[model samples]
Target: MAKPVLLNNITHQHLRVRTGPGAEFGDNQMAAPIIAAEFRQAQAHYPIVFRPTAGDGFEALALFGLAAGDNLFLSNDGWDADYVPLAVRRQPFLIGVSGQELTVHVDEDSARLRCGPDEGEAVFLEEGSPTPYLEQVNSMLFALHEGMLEMTGLIAALREHALLEAFVFEIELADGSERRLEGLYTINEEALAALDAAALDRLHRAGYLLPVYMVVASLSNFRALIERENRRYAVPR
Candidate 1:
């Protein structure tokens, strides 16, 4: 497992926590470390990860070392002072690339927005006027549809009977309250298999799995039987 490292101390409100690895240089990609000083005091470190980006920009990812569990507080990055509560009620967990821009539907009745990606440096969308939170709600629903599809792929690859059965996750709220989420949701394999390409595309267009990241697997944590199989297939060079 990679240990967390300190990145910065400044708490800029516009900070966005995205899912992509930072800029590429030559053939190497930079490690996106966390800024500890801003959120955690000088004492014990909070279970948070920070990745500093170009120009004073930064992104945060909270971790609780959960395997197979769902995280509800992952949407803290998309929270706004006025609409965060509404967002929390709808969908608490989020899955996507860490730093990609997101377009939010601000008006419930009209798809037009008061603001756009160009106006803000972060990954949220808003309108000049306040419509019922319903518009923003729809946007979130759309995003979640996509997120589930991308997450399903990762989950499917990890669902071997001997590999894993449970999960643990961390949830970080806007008010700085962090909670752990751990549970089991019956994997509906039949339903997942029935999904058609068009349904999958709708999820993708809604920004569920944009900016793909690596599907991480821990060799050290694999079951002994699985490890033996991996060794059997290992290429001898």
Candidate 2:
């Protein structure tokens, strides 16, 4: 449960957010929900996979690690990946809808909220206006909100075409131990290739073909993910 409160300049005038990547800020996540709008960028670093929702719908995700709570991309320096998914970037803040208007909400209990003065990026100016950091978070929240809307269409297209398939990943670690990942779903390339001409045209017209292909391209990152796991375990920590 998040302690969400509507962002107010007066009530939260002294807010300062810690923007750096660290496990303390809850960046130790194995996967995060991703929208189709960012597939091109996110696919470059993370494996784009689908997971089934409780309502039987599917949600796209950017996989960060092989095991639960394992984020191999995070290091003492910072996030290793060039492209951090928007979902991961937008932390401690969320967008809320009130009728037709959108509002910003912050998690009061988040570790990213700086406890010491002059410790992190300021959220507001001296006169109570939003700082550059807050402005950036606002933009990111809007993008995420819009991206979620776009994902509805993309998921619809995938469902209509029967393009998603469940899969299980069986990995042999460096220590000869086996790890089996289950309940993950991915694009079915065979079915995609076998689609009829009209189906392909429909997908293309809907602007979903590129993201579909992007999902396929992202699967290559799984090999790199395995390598990362191997390296993490090889180190004498």
Candidate 3:
């Protein structure tokens, strides 16, 4: 679905990406895939929850809203959160495989990309090299790539331990309307606490304990999500 093209001066000398947020580029429903490497940071701001993938096992995500097309984080002003996930940060650009090398590819149809140099941030320097903004995007992409690679093993650990459990969230809006959010999973703390000594040691040795606990700790952010929603609906607009 993405019309990605290799980022090159000849074909994209006028590339500029819009700065700030407000879902200007139609990214209102950005799904922030939280990885173990960023659990500490992500847990501070977003509710880290696991969602099942189609034959791909589970993925940890920072909950941006209660449902699709409802990113409570985005407003006319900008993103409300302090920490934006790496997946959401790398917009309009992606890592492309060219032989054995990874190159930058820009989404040609992205609303973020502009034709004029006067607005947004330039992708390339006036002298033809990558700009600082592009460099940052490159770093974000590489980090996200590596983080995703690490998530496979982390999720496997949880699955192998049988720690994943299904959950459903029922919410009551300010107007007294009730909605149910389903098909989510969470780490089973009871089973985690029931693990034998050797099993605990194995998880600790594998550096899995912290992320598991991080997920447990992040569940509290659901309260934050509720607060944001309440505020959004409470407004006259």
Candidate 4:
């Protein structure tokens, strides 16, 4: 249950957020939602893939682990990856929409919130001004909001070209145990390649060509993910 409330500096001036990566803060996710804006950098780290959403839509995700409730990048020292997805970084905070206005909302039930003076970074100054941390959160929220809108356009373009296909991932562990992953979708490279000049121009003009290629390149990171899993199980290569 999310207890979201409008963020106000006056009422929440004393609030502190215990930042840093940890399982208690809900960082132990196998995959996290991503946006087109993240593809360029995320491709170099996590395997970016598409998952089917309700109806005919699709949502992009950055795979973090092979199994449920696992995040190989998370450790006591913090996230192992150089780039943590904005979706993961913007925890316990959400953007709210009212008419044409966008508002910041905080999840009051999140463990990240602290009232102690020495516990974490303050969300606001004693004089009721936004802290640098809070400003960063605001930037993240706005970026996410804009990214979501871009995703809709990107997905629509892909769907228009019939460029998404479902596939299964089957891998064998060092112990000879097999794991099969399903319900995932990826770009149909063949279809993309076969697109005529006009269709290709449309996607390119929409500024989606680069991210599409980034997603394709990101599939190679599956090898890195396998290596991480093997290491987790202490399986020698």
Candidate 5:
């Protein structure tokens, strides 16, 4: 749970956040929600796909590993990938909404939080003000909040046009085993292409076309994910 970080929280001691990936910090999440703002860059690294939500709605995620509880990018040296998802980058700290305003919430039990210095990122200065690190987190939170609003609107537009279709991913592993991912959804290129001029205009007016194509383009990165897995296979066990 997050207690509202206030002057008392900072003045008494320090908010030290251990930087890097670790089980204690909860970076072990295999998939994370991402937005249109990140899709272009995320496409370069991970395969961005949409997963069905409980209410038949769709949400986008960046797939990190072939199996559950696996994150191929994580290592002793921190995240091995060149680009980390925005949701992953903003760990321990989350955005809270009070009516129309947003507040920053820090998970007290997070491994990122440390009472004192043991080689960790400080959330606040000794003088009780935001540090550069905390400032960056704030920026990320704001960007995420804004980006997600756009993402939600675009997804609704896709749904309006019936452009999303359920998909299944099948991979034949190096050991001759098969891995399957289901309950995922992707844009139907044919459906998108079949859109009438007026329908296309509506999507364009909502700034949805770019992101729709970005999600489609990201599927190619699945090959790169398999390559990452194959590297581990090359090592003598």
Candidate 6:
């Protein structure tokens, strides 16, 4: 039996494990036991984070930033920190598994895995590889990718409803400065006039419109018109 490691409270919602070290496992195999073990005998300490879709029966671990001589555990059928790789120790994250088919989502450009019941479990690439930051980045990127299409659809719906035309936008900067952006297109002035101050504030808070100095003209040449207006009015410093 594999022993569980003594991990800091830092190990919380971010940890995951799959049946195998990699994703190529056949359906017939029983679910592999995933375990996070801390080595009391070893000087190295790498926490467990994600298990890539590869390497059957292998476990992976993570440490945010590790130095030499750090002891950690590598669990397959048992636990041992001696086998953990040294080169991967320096990286913010590491994947250590026997086989090469581990599917790891590293960055924004990586191909997203399809969503399904068989969406394989997450596991460690190696038993004692440090990868805290990398695991967080992967989790966030996957979430953003999954929701992007839905977000785009919502934006399109808002545009088609002409709800975007109700107001302008003004983006406040971190330096206490501001930039005014035009609304989606134009406002139905009559409808806007009917809105109370609170309603208008709600729209502005929701990013429907931005406030600016002045408007010169409504034309296909809006960019040129803005330049002309800025010269005359000297747009807010």
Predicted model with the maximum TM-score: 2
Residue pairs with backbone atoms closer than 3 Å in model 3 (clashes): none
TM-score of structure candidate 6: 0.23
Q: Estimate each model's TM-score.
A: 0.22, 0.96, 0.92, 0.95, 0.90, 0.23
Prediction 1 global C-alpha lDDT? 0.30
Give the lDDT of residue 232 in candidate 1.
38
Query: What are the Cα lDDT values of the candidates?
Result: 0.30, 0.90, 0.83, 0.90, 0.81, 0.31
Q: What is the C-alpha lDDT profile of model 6 across 53-84, one tens digit per residue? A: 24321122232211222211222442232433
Ranked by TM-score, the better of candidates 1 and 2 is 2
Instruction: After the best TM-score superposition of candidate 2, give how far the Cα of residue 151 lies from its true spot, in angstroms.
Output: 0.8
C-alpha root-mean-square deviation, each candidate: 19.4, 1.6, 2.0, 1.6, 2.4, 22.7
Model 1, residue 87: distance off in Å is 6.6
lDDT of 2: 0.90
Task: Rank the candidate models, highest lDDT first.
Answer: 2, 4, 3, 5, 6, 1
- Of 2 and 4, the candidate ahead on TM-score is 2
User: What value does the lDDT take at residue 175 in candidate 3?
Assistant: 69
| Candidate closest to the true structure, highest lDDT | 2
TM accuracy, model 3: 0.92
Candidate 5 per-residue C-alpha lDDT over 149-192 given as tens digits, one digit per residue, 9 for 90 to 100: 77778888988888888888889878677778888888999999
Candidate 3 weakest lDDT stretch, 10 residues: 22-31
* Tens-digit per-residue lDDT, 146-177, candidate 3: 87778888888898888999999999988677
Candidate 6, after superposition: displacement of residue 60 in Å?
36
User: Which pairs of residues collide in candidate 2?
Assistant: none
Residue 180 C-alpha lDDT in model 5: 86
Model 3 stretches with alpha carbons more than 4 Å out: 235-237
